[model samples]
Target: MNHPATPQEQDYPLSAVPLEARKSLASMGLVLLGFTFFTATMWAGGSVGTAFDFQTMLLVLLIGNLLLGTYAAILAFIAARTGLNTALMSRFAFGQVGSKLSDFILGFTQIGWYAWGTATMAILLVKMTGLSQAWEMPLMVVFGFGFCISAFIGYRGLEWLSRFAVPAMIILIAVSMTIATNDGGGLAGLSAIVPSEDMSMAAAITLVFGTFVSGGTQATNWTRFARSGKAAVVATLAAFFIGNGLMTLVGAFGALVYQQADIVDILVAQGLATLGILMLFLNLWTTQDNTVYNFAVAGCNMFRTRRRKLVTVVGAGVGTLLAVLGMYEWLIPFLILLGTFIPPVGGVIMANYFVAWRARYPDLETASLPAFNLPGLAAYGLGSLAAYTSPWIAPVVGVVAAALAFALIHVATVAVKERRAEMMKPV
Candidate 1:
């Protein structure tokens, strides 16, 4: 396959980002923070908030986000070290052709997120403004395509939007939280509140972790541009651990105070409908662009093309159609699948890089790889199965199972080959 001789600025979808093109910690941190500040995460938080007391809910959010942050940070460090995103890294674990499986899985999940966000933005606009119900579908198409413009411009576009949006979002969140605390009767009233519903700790953690695990797996797209592994790790941890944790906190707080999980609804109840709508737009747009950009990167790897802009537009179109067809309702099941299947990809990639490649991959342009890597494929399958049936935290189970399976399979395969070679020697 012919790789591009000269890559476009900041988007090296088919190749590693060069050292000169790497970015600072604050740049990557802002972009990732924007991506993690999502509405669905709030919805997931709302679910957990209603299920437990405030103290227990805080514990669950902490544990769940810590797992997510650590997982993403590992991938981010590897990406920064290798200058390759998850899709490109998958080529080593899953092989050149087999990597398409990850491309599809990762790309499709991002499309789901894009569609959900698009549908959400349109639906809420209509609900809040008393626009005709008929306007929702048209609005979805308009917002869906509009959201991809930043993604089409690639990393630079994402950085510009995030710089403005992240701070504005933070301010909005702080305002909403202050109002919520006062309305809930402050610390005494909050502590006095009891759970109105029940959920297992495992399930609650899953809800928190599962909501963004897929996005975390693919965050390497931006993390690959980090100036160093330390920068990547710090930025990713801040985004997933703090940014995502804060989102869940807001949602849960809203749920506990007003029996509403969505931040927009919470704001509306607080008589900040104007600011809430603005927050909603900023929240979804930041994440929507990133999500579509992710799909474009995965598509580039899948199709072996450097036309990321073209692929981005196509991805938005597909997501828009899905939104019109009712993707908003699939949020729960989608998160569950993401939590179960996606972590194993990261697991296999970690094992492949650290164990097989010894923490260094050969230059992508010169490396010779097989069409398929059977050991990696088998390990992923086994890992996914372990996640499916395990009663513990499924995402964590999947990652560990897949990594162990890859190691054992590699060792066994090498031993058999060595024995066969010994048997064939002249005696």
Candidate 2:
């Protein structure tokens, strides 16, 4: 098969890999900087802080976020090098045919998240509006309309939303942290806050790891626009470490200041209900837009359909219906399960681009699509099975299993190919 010409080598490029308007380091930094304040981390940190001392909670938070952030940065670097979305990149690793399985799994997981996010936003809006009873229906309509519009605008709009949301979140977090610190009666106040005996260290660890690893599903999507590998690494590291870390810290402070587990309630108690509403709106908007956009893209890819706006509208409508039905609470367990389900896809992608095809091709822009490889399929299936079966292993087992499976399969394939070539020696 003929190798595709590189972006630098192509004459009249038939496929335009969507080019992101080149952003500055700071703008890119903000985009990557969301990990510090993910809603899940905020919830988990508050929950953990209610039980453990701030120091203990910090230890777990640091370890989990650091490890996950590092892994994400590495994956982002690979994604930047290839300039392919996660699912498209997986095709090379899992074979064009096998990668569809990966796409299906990821698409399903993201759709669930989109539903959960829409539901959460509706609930937040209901609380903000303070309408007693009969608010669910209106909230669902509002959520459906808002989410469909946001998703229809797609990635370009999301990039703009991130720019506005990230700074706003930062400022709100600063305000919330300041208020919480004062309300807690200073750093000395944490000592007086009684810890809950029922909270286990394992649970806290799981919460931290689960929240930090939750973004694994979007690894390639975020990094696809990166101008260079360094850009991707920097963006991922900054987002996870600085952005997500600070958000969790604020949640911990919220727990220490108020005896409540809910961070939003704590903000309301502090007379900052408006700020709380804004933060929730921004958080949900950015995250939900991402979910809907990815769902639309995946849907388009699967059906070879061009109805991006329709897919987004349909997805948002479904999510809104679930919200109206009050399924948000029930969906938490499934979201956690999805957290485990996605990491193996990241592992498989990482193994393919960084290991199996590393030396063979300088870049995806110039390389021929790799042959259909069955070993990659087997590895992904086994890894997914392990993730499904081993609930206690958190994310490591699936990641390791997927990586090893891909590597072993690729090595065996290469060796077989080499032996076949030698047997057909030329005169």
Using all chains and alpha carbons, the TM-scores for the candidates as numbered come to 0.97, 0.86
RMSD of each: 1.6, 4.4
- Candidate 2 per-residue C-alpha lDDT over 300-361 given as tens digits, one digit per residue, 9 for 90 to 100: 55554556677778777767776676666754366457557677877787787767777233
Summarize candidate 1's per-residue lDDT along 1-427 as a digit string, tens digits.
2244454534998889888888989999999999999989999998887888878888999999999999999999999999999999999999999999999999999999999999999998987787999999999999999999999988889999998889988987898789889988998887777878788999888878889999999999999999999999999999999999999998898788887566567777988877778888988999999999999999999999988988999999999999999998999899999999999999999999998899999988789999999999999999999999989899999999999999999889989999999999999
Once fitted onto the true fold, the runs of candidate 1 whose alpha carbons sit more than 4 angstroms away are 1-10
Question: Clash number for every model?
Answer: 0, 7
Query: Which predicted model would earn the best lDDT?
Result: 1
Distance from true position, residue 193, model 2, in Å? 3.3
